[model samples]
Target: MRVSRAETTMNYVLLLGFAAFALAPVITILVTAVSAPLGESGGIHLGNFARAWTIGGFGRTLGNSAVVAVIVVTTATALSILAGYAFGTMHFRGATVLFYLFLLGMMIPAEATIIPLFFDLRTLGLTDTYLAIALPQVAQSIAFGTFWLRAQFRALPVSLIEAAALDGAGPLRALVQILVPASRPAIVTMVVLVFMWTWNEFLIALIMAPGGRLRTAPLGLANFQGQYTAETALLAAGAVIVALPTVILFLLLQRHFIRGMLEGVAK
Candidate 1:
């Protein structure tokens, strides 16, 4: 079958329209961030970023977010891979129930759990610490990570695992040497998503460690707004500053991310 020229032209038009529609807000944000200040004439004022940085204390807060994201993504991805492999490949009693238990973590919202988490972490003397934010996020990330990787692993060909076994390789060897390498695309996708979620997490970070040295970027931006909302250019610049890392990250790994997602859906 061949697509006619008319149909191809229509497809391109629709795609371009959708692309522009999606990109409109991002273009607006960039323009707003760089536009001349009100009542001032300039090509593109760069001072707004400087002002937002100083006012927002974005240096400290972005560092805090980086730390949390690294810890959460690393810990959660490692744990999820192990758990997903076990649940997807191994035979055991109550496995369905256990997997469902992990799924419950995904079903529950952070808002519903944040209050109790605050008290619990405070009691454990972990509140206002990086761990306070990282722990819950790790748990949350692991839930979805486990679900994602489990589905990916279950879709693997059984003959591959059986071949490894016949060669006298144990489970750990089989996983690390064979399955993990084979599942690179799926794992990269999970890492990217978990990093994005952990980086942008606001509710738990705010509730668990508000107004202290542990304030993440979003919290810092929130506080920045309260003090400097009148400066719209600076505010827009601050938003752009905080969002840049995630955008850069997604752009770098987008191919792997899309491949992983497609693999998950295929399975």
Candidate 2:
């Protein structure tokens, strides 16, 4: 049935409201980054952003965030894609139990496990390193990423695999050649999700690297707040610098992302 005009109108209204709600803060942040001048400025001073960059130690924090996010996304995607393919397509005993164990990560709060992780990291002397921040994100990301990609992998016709086998192609060959190419949409979806989460992650960064030992961008932003109350412009600039990459990534990959979601939902 066609949607009623009244329903469409209501939907549009709700959509506009949501759009405004979501964008208002982003606009505020960007505007403030340029003009609000978070601290020590009589009014709006664009110089505030540069000051925040230096004083807040944004350079180090940004580098730390970059390294951690890059490592997490790469490891998470590689492991999840491989495991997802196996779990979704190949048959095996104990798979169900293992998948359930993986699901347990979802139920447990990241916060709840931080203390134990801290002790574990302390023992290994990995604390304050990019590895410490990245490993947990990888582990946390894998479960859902695996589950998501498994469905994508499974959606392919088994006949493809059978045909590849008839042609003397091994399982790995078929997966690498045929399955992976066909599943790019889903992989892009996972990439976007993981990157965004890892980029914006604050708590893990906070616990893993305090005192700007290895500050991430979010931590830098927070530290910026403490150092400058009047240089809001600088804060805004830093935030924009931090935010734009993710937004650009989303824009470039959104079509594949939508297709992946639609296909997953249909399956």
Candidate 3:
């Protein structure tokens, strides 16, 4: 059925309205970040970012977040690819039970387990370190990645796998050389999501790295907000700094991300 011109116009209007609603706060923040702080008179205050960076110690915190994101994304994606392939293609005893166990990670809330997790990490003497922050997120990411990639793998034609096997390709070879390349969009989507979650994670970093030495970007931004409560420009700048990486990553991978999400939904 063809949509009427009035309906098309109405849809465009609704979409534009939603787009503005979503972007208004971001635009306001960007404007505030560059504007002169209250009781000051000047042009664009680019120096607020520098001041925020120094006072917030964002150099260290951003570095820490980057490290954690890398560790979580790399480890979770690799493990999830292998696990998803197994779960999607292979049949074994207890496979259903094991898959549901992985799904349990998704069912459970982080808040429910964070306190116990902290104590467990403390007992192991892993607290106040990068592993303390990265490890939990890696586990969480793997659960989600496995669920996502499994569907992607299952949606592929079985003939591809059969063809690879007929050509004397082993499972590992088939995965690395054939399936992985075919599932690039899904893999990229998982990586982007995992990186964003790991980068923005605050409670885990706050609880695990209590010493503040390994504070992630979001954690540092919270601390910066506390100290600069009256410095609106500086606070806005810090918020932007913390959010910029995820925004950049999303923009760069938006095509693959959107395609993967659509495909996943269709599958």
Candidate 4:
């Protein structure tokens, strides 16, 4: 069936409307962020960024966020790949039960678990540290990562595995040489997603490192906001500073991300 001109026009119009709705606030933020921060002389400039950076202590916060994101993504992806391969290919007793237990992480909300999580971390003397945020986020990322990569791995040709086995390839070699290369797009997509989630995560950061030196970017921005409630331009600048990395990451990896989604959906 062909789409009519009228329908196509309507679809374009609706898409443009949605785009505008989504982009308006972002544009507003960019405009405000670049504009002169309250009473400062001259026209739009980059000084707001400088001020926001200093005021928010973004140097340290961004470093903290980067550290957490790197650790979580690395650890979670590695674990997920192993777990995914196991669930996708290996048939063993109690696998279903264990898989379901992993799925329970997906079913539960972070808010529901955060209280106990904080207590557990505090008891372990990990609060106000990078692991406080990294571990929980890793757990969350692993749950979804396992689910996503399992589907990706499961969709691969069985012949590939059999051929690798016939060639005397160990499971580790098979995963690294055969499966990983083929699953690059899925892995990249997962990394980008997990990075975005971990970077923007606020509640966990706020609770885990409240007033601590190790606060993540989001927490730093929040603290900055409290101190500068009247400084809208500064706030906007700080937000952009905090959010720009994820935006750049998504833009860079959007193709692989979309391909991964399409493959997952198709499978």
lDDT of 4 by residue, 44-129 (tens): 87888998898789999899999999999999999999999999988999999999999988999899999998988899999988
Each prediction's TM-score against the native?
A: 0.96, 0.89, 0.98, 0.95
Looking at model 4, the pairs that clash are none
Poorest 10 consecutive residues of model 3 by lDDT? Answer: 258-267
Candidate 2 per-residue lDDT over residues 1-64, each given as its tens digit: 8999999999999999999999999988867776744235455566756766677777777788
Stretch of 10 with least lDDT, candidate 2: 36-45
- Per-model CA lDDT versus the true structure: 0.90, 0.84, 0.93, 0.91
RMSD of each: 1.3, 2.5, 0.9, 1.5
TM-score for candidate 1 = 0.96
lDDT of 4 at 9: 100
* Number of the top lDDT candidate: 3
**Poorly placed runs, candidate 3 (over 4 Å):** none
Write model 1 residue lDDT over 1-267, tens digit each, in one string.
999999999999999999999999888888888877667887898887997898789999999999999999999989999999999999999999999999999999988888988999999999889999999999999999999889888999999899999999999999999999999999999998888888888888888886578999988888888987777777789999999999999999999889888887787
On a 0 to 100 scale, what is the lDDT of residue 210 in model 3?
A: 93
Q: Model 4 compared with the native: what TM-score?
A: 0.95
